[model samples]
Target: MAAFPYYDTPAIDALNAQAVALLKLFAERGYVREEPAVLQPAEIFLDRSGEEIRRRTFTLMDPSGRELCLRPDLTIPICRQVVQEGRKFPARIAYNGLVFRHQPGEPHRATQFFQAGVELLGLEDRAAGETEILSLTIEALRVAGLKQFSLRIGDLALFGALVDALALPDGWRARLKRHFWRAGYVESLLYWLGHGDGKAKLPGTRAEIEALLDARADAPMAGRSREEIISRAMDRAVEAAALHLDPAVADAIAKLLDISGPAEGALISIRALLKTAGINLDPQLAAMDGRLATLKSLGVDPGQVQFTAHFGRNMEYYTGFVFELWARDKEGPVQIAGGGRYDSMMEMLGAKKPVSAIGCAIRTERVLAAKIAGGA
Candidate 1:
């Protein structure tokens, strides 16, 4: 009967009540609640939010020839606010609002959904911040009455560090980091890096370019003269020639990326892989162990989490820890909430300096849907 797909009175009331409950929990944790404007500048989302968000953001033009967009997600806008206000260290912020995004498929998925959560900012300890964010997410979902859920955790820093520890030069390291999240590319990369052309004349591996720095001697050509074409070839070579990688190294890293299991044994497997490669993930591992202890102290079961060495979350902004909470429905498991640590993103968002930030956002719509399907 309505012109557009939207919640009727009862549904709207339910969503509002859920938002209120989550906000109340955040407030109790010392997070000051703030309501941000819905319309935001387009440039921020376009430049920093990654391609997935950029494509779906609803953009518009103002009378004064300025570009604006409906807030695709709340994290960036909040960070933008923190930057603009010049907020002091360790800001605890709680916000609840409707965010607009274009969901092309999945009829049940909300195009515009109500999200409520908190962001812990400017913390000095990365492990402590990640643990707190994850613990709070678990508590909030429990409060919302979701009975069964899984938390998949990942760390880009750990994965990146392992790749760095490999013998690959900086160019190869950059390539691997950039494509780590994409499907299928990783496996192909490993084999190609280790075994390429019969001649195995990949640019970085080629005798002509010595360790990617040798290109400095090449004359500038066309539009990209200052080692332009050479630099481009080096990058392309890095992309194409996994040919130079030793079979042992490629297999070792591949095995590392494949590590995934319950937190109980996941840590053991990860440690073994790192040790085998002579990779020193001591600092990151120690931080991870600290996070587990904290989670246990907070009454969360470490066994419930699944850790993946290669699993980077959807958002490109995350640089350290990442997590998602999913509850099973008639269809399958659906993600109801997610968050991660982006220690450097705030500075990119206009902050004078980088801040250690971790936060979780709950999809009130998904939470409710999953509950109904689970007979809650």
Candidate 2:
């Protein structure tokens, strides 16, 4: 018979040692190390996580019949810990633990995974916090023996601004943004913008017109016919036209769709796009730009890092920057580490104030696999 495999294998031992060393480094940096409970109240996760996440959580009843769930992610539970303990702001806490999510028949995607990260609370300096989190992530990846990975960053705030600039109806705006990252929806969006194949129908336009017409017909004018109301609605449509595309709005959308090149070039293009759109460079945005400049000054090659405008992870809670590290040549499940900013999460978890939080989880098995494949 074949020899039984042991968790004490040299490869696994090496990865664990690296993880412990990184954890110690984080602790030395004034990050309060805490081991979070592996299980938590199911409701806590269900309330904050998006619909897709809620479905995947591993849940069961406790001894007293209280619903319990194996932690799906650390951020939410950390928020819960803060709320329960009434922790003060500007608090820096770090945790290293395994989280469980239910996945049947998915061997590579295990139900159990390790998460190591920090949450910085009450930091009014959003940009500083974002920069620190990203820096920490890069450092962790380097320590974990991942050297040839590029950071793909994006801002939901910029995307939100583009949406507001469009002046699209509320329903349409919501629908379009919901489908923005979806594959095969680019043509649909272009169609909605009156540029591509006009296949999909916009709902409720006729109903809205009919409602306006009926109200006008019932107004002070006595015995007004329905035809008059329809005529008035048609006049309104002709005057307003079909949501004329503002040049600025067009430029913003174009920028988001234009995902190419390395980080520096992307930033230059983004700045130009914003300038053409007449968007005043807000201090928050400026600070982010400055942070990138600092990173470049530190000898980090901007050309080596890709900034994808719409490259968001599947997670919905990421409010600011999001990134994934991948091997330069590997194709399947290439992620080595990934995380982003989640400012509003504490509030979502019933905390008194917003927590300025960012984190990255390194997939140890994947890291080891890559290292071995690279003959490291």
Instruction: Go through the candidates in order and give each one's C-alpha lDDT.
Output: 0.78, 0.67
CA RMSD of each candidate after superposition = 5.1, 7.4
Off by over 4 Å in 2: 1-6, 9-12, 61-67, 102-106, 168-244, 247-255, 275-288, 328-333
Candidate 2 per-residue C-alpha lDDT over 253-332 given as tens digits, one digit per residue, 9 for 90 to 100: 66556666677677677777777766654643565577577567645677656877776635667777776767532434
Error of 1 at 334 (Å): 1.2
Q: Which stretches of candidate 1 lie above 4 Å from their native place?
A: 1-4, 105-108, 196-244, 301-303
Q: Which ten residues in a row have the lowest lDDT in candidate 1?
A: 197-206
* Decoy 2 TM-score against native: 0.74
* Candidate 1 global Cα RMSD: 5.1
TM-score of 1: 0.84
